[model samples]
Target: MDTPCAERSESYIPNAIVGYGYTEMAMQEMDEQGFGSDTPSGARRVSGVSSSRRVDRQTGRAGFGAQFRLRFSRSVMPRTQKGRIAGAVALFASLGLLAGAGYEGQHFLLHDERFVVPGSSAIQIEGNSHLTRAQLLSVFGEDVDRNIFTVSLAQRRTELERLPWVEHATVMRLLPDRLRVSIVERTPVAFVRQGSKIGLVDRTGVLLDMDDDSETASKGAPVQYSFPVVTGVSEDDPASVRSARMKIYLKFASDLDSSKENISSKLSEVDLSNPEDVKALIPDHGTEILVHFGDSDYLDRYRKFEAQLPQWHTQYPKLASADMRYDRQVVLEMQAGASVPTNNTQTAEASDPTPAPIKHAAPRPAAKKTAAPERGRPHTKLAAMGQPHFPDESAPTGKHVISSKPARQ
Candidate 1:
């Protein structure tokens, strides 16, 4: 009778030793025939079933590895929008906490008194000559006690510079409890005269206040300054015109300052009332003489006048005014009733190339004599006077002299 398949399969493995020997023999036969060789129907079915089981097990293992990789990737990466949003929120929260800590630290530093300027002893000032220490302190005002971190350096500088003598100011914190201030004071170049009021002004035309008693004391004494007074510039004038005039005045003053004779020291005032013809007042023998100096060649003209001043003064003892604007000649205006000395004719002719020769005509007859001139009446006459010869080749060779009319004093 045909046995059932299960029963036949079970009888094939009835004993362990027999089953193991049968398995080894099957493996040897398979190796000898090659793994892919065709076999009997029963062996073929068993081999096909073993191969399918192995392939299924390998496929299951591959699927399990793939699933493991997918789970690991999902765990490590922010795959969902919610996960990405949560990460962004955590990053911003950390930044906010850092910002709050910084804000608190800064607030504490600003209020700290260790950085505050306590008093004048803790503050160092430099470059101030005309401005007093009190004046600079006043500029700090209520902000003196404020912490250095809270102090407005720009504002303090502006306030310090507002003082008339301060041209520029710099303010800075010098570490814990100290402040440093440096000032550039305006240097007075000349005095400004406007309608009887005199004020000090710098080369740039900035007016400096002279009304402060502290400023005078800072200079060590209430002294009278011997600066040349600049006239004719008014506050009503346009700024451009005033600036131009100031530049011209400074140029003239500088030239005088450079002279070997120190002519600037003798200068009493500068007359700019007539812009075309600038005049300078110089004290000569206790008399203030008005000197006409045209716009150019200030140094050359001044030197020439200085060289001939003594000779001219000797010749004309009462010299009232002088015109030195001429290239080669300087016209002299003498006091009325002054007679030209006879011996000076040769001296004057030798010194000046121009001027009519001194000629004495024969006395007119007595009949021509008119009524004696009134004693108290003033007599004015025009006289042409020659100038001293200058060795400069740039001077004009042609002879020229300006006639002068003495005015009643």
Candidate 2:
């Protein structure tokens, strides 16, 4: 290097890259290192700058670090903006493809024949007791042979629940040509007599008309329920009113049978006309007498009646009804000159066929149509006798009254 300044300065100037991420002093310092005594006056006067190396050993090139820094820094910002744009395009393209696939799949499900409900056999029913398949199938008659997805499950469920036997029903699509219907049948709590028509009633007071086909079919046997006949629930009464009366009736039975001795089984009929004073007809020894249990303490009242029955039977030879609602005494009604309703007399005859018919208010006109029961099985008739009058708490003398604890005893 006879003339390092002239030779190197010429080469360094050609390769020096001016760009961002650099200071003026660094460039001046780099220039001083590249040049020495022979450096030109114009180049030596430069200051407050920084720059990269003047040469690359491998290629004998100048300003390699500076060129790389300038190119890399300059491209970083522009490439970042370009990368965001490209990523946005790719995301939008993926979403469009997904939406298209979804639309196509939905179309296939709606119109595909493979998914159509074939026929009545494609429908599956479960959890039915007395409900026949024909009766439940009637609800989905229109849905048969239609696309399973097109069938409104909610609408079918509502229609199924409207049937007398269904307390709750669930309808669902069973995929690829079928619908499934599940029914929760209403439980029969008591035998309800609407006029002369005998049916079963649930706790909610909804009357259930059992399937005639199932009963008559050779494969299905007749369903027999051991329950007392409940009165005061009429077809004309609103469901709320019927339910309210049924509540009182349920409480009466629950309380009487709390001991599990089947105390409630002794009752042949229960009158729920007055919630405040519920009445039950019980057969003790031979004669059946109606006992007024009232609203609360039914079990206690029933027990008290049982305890005092021996003394009462001895004292009164002909006992018709007893009011056990009083705190200390039970009011007794004698059979002679008694004003018992026709229901009591009729039920009495049903329980004991030997009893002669007692005279009552003239029998009401017979209904226009009555279904003749099967020859072997007899239907219980709980004829309504309007509302019966029980002794009031205020007027003890209205009927014959005696202390619950007898002085003689």
Candidate 3:
């Protein structure tokens, strides 16, 4: 080797190494050249650093452990922003897998029959007064095994409301295969009469059934009649009441009929001309009188009429008609009293016996021509009764005064 000044200064260079076979000074020169040197002193130096043989052997080539360490340190520490992003992505992926598994498990547990309502679960039926346990169960279809919690509440309520009698229903879960159902049943209130047949109805007029015992008992007790029987405003005549007004009429008729014996002879027909006015059509021999009942005050009218009956029957025995519509006045129409028989005997001399032989003096006065009654107010008859010519005030007490003059056509 040639001596050089560049080699002479190598020992002081930090990047240089010197050893083995080469003299210390020569090693120092090689060290100055930045070259690795081998030394027999049981140590080795490469590029100014001591290293294991494995490291020295791997140092010249790409190391798998070094690549692995770079990746592993990034994964373990996650110190850099890029490393943190990778770590977050991996953590999110793991969490997503776990969440997916948990969601699927919950879905399967709730919907699946094996996990939710098993076959061994017990069921209970409540609010079953009219319906039996079997009847209630049959409504849910044959697929259901009577496990209450296993079945959906919405499904069970749908089944219950379908029943004919159930107006409303509720289904509840008791847990552990137990179920409870409550029901509300429709109830009847009255019987709506339809010709010969009657249909059961509620108070609101909802039709339920025909000839049902529940409806009949709820509506009314049985009533018997020889003539026609009508319910719910069968007639629309002026003498009839409206449908909604029939309840009071039926009740009153029922009560009146109970006392038939006292009123049967005097009353020919019951006229409901005014629902408020119960007119009694009474017959006096050949003629009839429309006796107006004062009002709904039936007790007072009945008592007054009952007291007047005895005297009227005797005095007006042959009277054509009588009007007792007024509280104070009673009008009498006489068949015999109005027309009195007048006998005219003309005296003449005759050859036969008896009272004709006696001649009487000639009468010197002429009778005045009598005018017939004008309209219903008879002037002569009114004058004979010694009363001023005014309209008849023979109307029922409390009734508004009506004009006696006929309404012009």
Alpha-carbon deviation at 34 in model 2, angstroms? 22
Sorted on lDDT, highest at the top, how do the candidates line up? 2, 1, 3
Candidate 1 is scored at a TM of 0.59
**Where's the lowest-lDDT run of ten residues in candidate 3?**
378-387
Candidate 1 structure quality by residue, lDDT tens digits, 107-222: 87888778877877777888876677877888776766778787788998988877778889999888887888999998877776544346777766677656545565657675
For all predicted structures, in order, the TM-scores are 0.59, 0.64, 0.31
Residue-level lDDT tens digits of model 3 in 251-326: 4444445566544334433333355555544544444444555345454556555565555455434333334456
Candidate 2 lDDT over 139-185, as tens digits, reads 88998778888898889999999888888999988778888889998
Worst 10 residues of 2 by lDDT: 387-396
For candidate 1, what is the lDDT? 0.60
Candidate maximizing TM-score = 2
Clashing pairs in 3: 10-32, 20-39
Candidate no. 2 TM-score: 0.64
> How many residue pairs clash per model?
0, 10, 2
lDDT-better candidate, 1 vs 2: 2
Among the numbered candidates, top lDDT falls to: 2
